[model samples]
Target: MRITRVLGATALLFALAVPPAVADSAPSPSASGDDAAPTTAGTSFRTAAEVEQGQQATASASTGDYLYWSFPADAGQRPTVRATVKLPDAHAAQSWQIDVYDGLRRRQACQYGAQTRTAAQGAASVDLSCTLRTVRSWSEPWANDPLPGTYYVRLTALNVATADLGQPISASVRVGSKDVGGSAAVDGSLAEPLVPGIAVTSKSGEDDGDAAKSAVLAGLEPEDGWASGWWSDRWVWTAVGGVLAALAGVGGYALTRGSGRPGRVPPGA
Candidate 1:
């Protein structure tokens, strides 16, 4: 009976340990699932259609027209952009390409996949894809490394016959991302992703000059001198100015305060 009791106890402990093991082994879901599929694409970054990682964006555009789509990418994610263009009927051989650009409008190099493809004469469609490098949690501002931000996919026909320039063509694009796990994490993180849709509210009743960040972000940032044009210095200067102003007011009050105390009349009142 003792042996059976010990065996049951062992089984219970094993069951208790199984949850963390299962959770650790499960693959993380793609980060771009918050948005829906885009029915049409944008002509530029400002108007780019927004879509999630798995959602597909389709647009009815001309062969030579530029199609643009945007999606959010987080740190440690390796994003791959895939595009398909349906060639117009009875058109000559045409070439198409897919390009990815970061939020700064800088073009990103593809780590793999066919970024450009040419369709044969009378071909129905052409496929193009670009797999980008993993997004970094932090990096130097001068470096062109991929950081957490909004990414854009641009599709265009490289070469098309004059007759096919305005020909009706169908275009589709999808961005998919893979989580690279904690190994890709860095010591620092971006203050915010480079998505244009994000906005911070300004503090009310504060000076327009750097006062917006003087209290909050500046407090958290390092005070030691670093580089010029750094916003942190603005906070430091504002704080010093405020302290000096307060000291001046206090000194003026002390000097101007009458020597006689209130309600204390001297000699004959």
Candidate 2:
């Protein structure tokens, strides 16, 4: 009876202890608040506004238009970006492409997955998800390190017909970050969020002087070494908390079982 009671007590304690730890450590679901409205045309990186991680944003564009968005990241963090695009039913099929670029406007390799539907099938839409692995920004001078800074995501329509030139398409974007357990310290800071001369210039080299000035005034530069330190990763701490809680539960169960052994019965008294 004593052994049974001890085991029951231990099980109860473990059940009670584990839940709180898991709840505290697990990543919270991203809020389903009102969609964020995209500000600039987002055709270029310079005009792109910062997107808060895990928040959804909405934008409107035509076929062939390149929509851009910027996200801040740390060196050791892996980020996943997703986009859902809604198109007009007038077209039978369409192709879309999304790309990720680093601070220097260099393209970063990513894994891409997509789902497409035609108007006849129901709604014309495409869902895209891209993931980039952890990057070490300062590892080498010539390497295109996925450094911590403002990263750009550009979305383009590939097969728009001439008749669909002015048709409006809507897009929703979301970004999520996960820590891959790397060094806490970052190497340096970005001098400016807008990539120098790249922001205001069109592919044909046409310049928007006013847009350039406004970008400078926006003061969007993140603090130097902003990605540094272990505390940045909340998930890491949550995982650690869960592990400790499990260990404690096991230890408590063992100790209780040892102590609740009925005192050895005093030699069969």
Candidate 3:
């Protein structure tokens, strides 16, 4: 009778402990999520000269690849432009082209590059073992005169022999000169200064129409820095909860058996 009672108590304690375990395993709202739009830190022009030479330029290609420009956007002011390219899968891409564009999607500068690895070579490669590596990279400084105002960037990928798969991905940003006083756009209501880098504020009110028009003319996108998610995130929490439940069950079983050992004396008895 005593042994059975102890077992019952052990099971109850385990059941109680299981809830906490599951709670711990539960995924937080921030976890298991994809990156949203890029955050604006506001415009920061180091000197007056940079703001004066605002020229709108672009970099793009016929083939998909990477588009990059150096920061400090002033032609004579900054050095070392860096850029990122998100490629499709290796098997999905046979050839690549890169381009830079003005705000209007008109080509400004371009470079052609290709990356290919045999199925055997890629399968045997180090990068694709676990995570999918589907991105390319490029960077160049303002070796040429800096053109400011607004710029559009893009990368396109294609199948080797055919032009059928013309997947183009692009982003837009503003490049103000020092004359603009290193500008930033806000919702006009938030009145919050964006970070010190050139930015195109998405949030706009009637009062901000002028700023918005100027930004759009310069080729920057009106982004509130918010975009809907592609997939529901609730599943992530469900998965985390399931894991915790299992852990709690295991811990409870262990503790129950340990505490229910028959060797201990009962004072009430």
Highest-TM-score candidate: 1
- Residue 94 of candidate 3: its Cα lDDT? 47
- Candidate 1 lDDT by residue in tens digits, 1-269: 44455445555644653322112111233334424456788998777887766667788998888888887776667888888888777888889999999878889999999998989999999989898887887789899988766788899998688877898999878777766644455567766566553323133324453544433221111112111222222354456556556655655665667564777588986
CA RMSD, predictions in order: 22.2, 9.2, 17.7
Where does candidate 2 clash, by residue pair?
A: none
- Error in Å for residue 212 of model 2: 14
Best prediction by lDDT: 1
- Evaluated against the true structure, the overall lDDT of model 2 is 0.62
Candidate 2 residues 119-190, lDDT tens each? 332257888878876655355668666776667888887666677667788988887766654334344544
Q: After superposition, how far is residue 250 of candidate 1 from its true place, in Å?
A: 67
TM-score of each: 0.63, 0.59, 0.26
Give the count of colliding residue pairs in each prediction. Answer: 0, 0, 35
Q: Which stretches of candidate 2 lie over 4 Å from their true place?
A: 1-41, 115-123, 183-225, 229-269
Predicted candidate 3 versus true structure: per-residue lDDT over 91-123, tens digit per residue: 332433333333223344322222222222112
In what order do the candidates fall by lDDT, top score first? Answer: 1, 2, 3
Runs with alpha carbons beyond 4 Å of true place in candidate 1 = 1-35, 197-269
Q: Which residue pairs show backbone clashes in model 1?
A: none
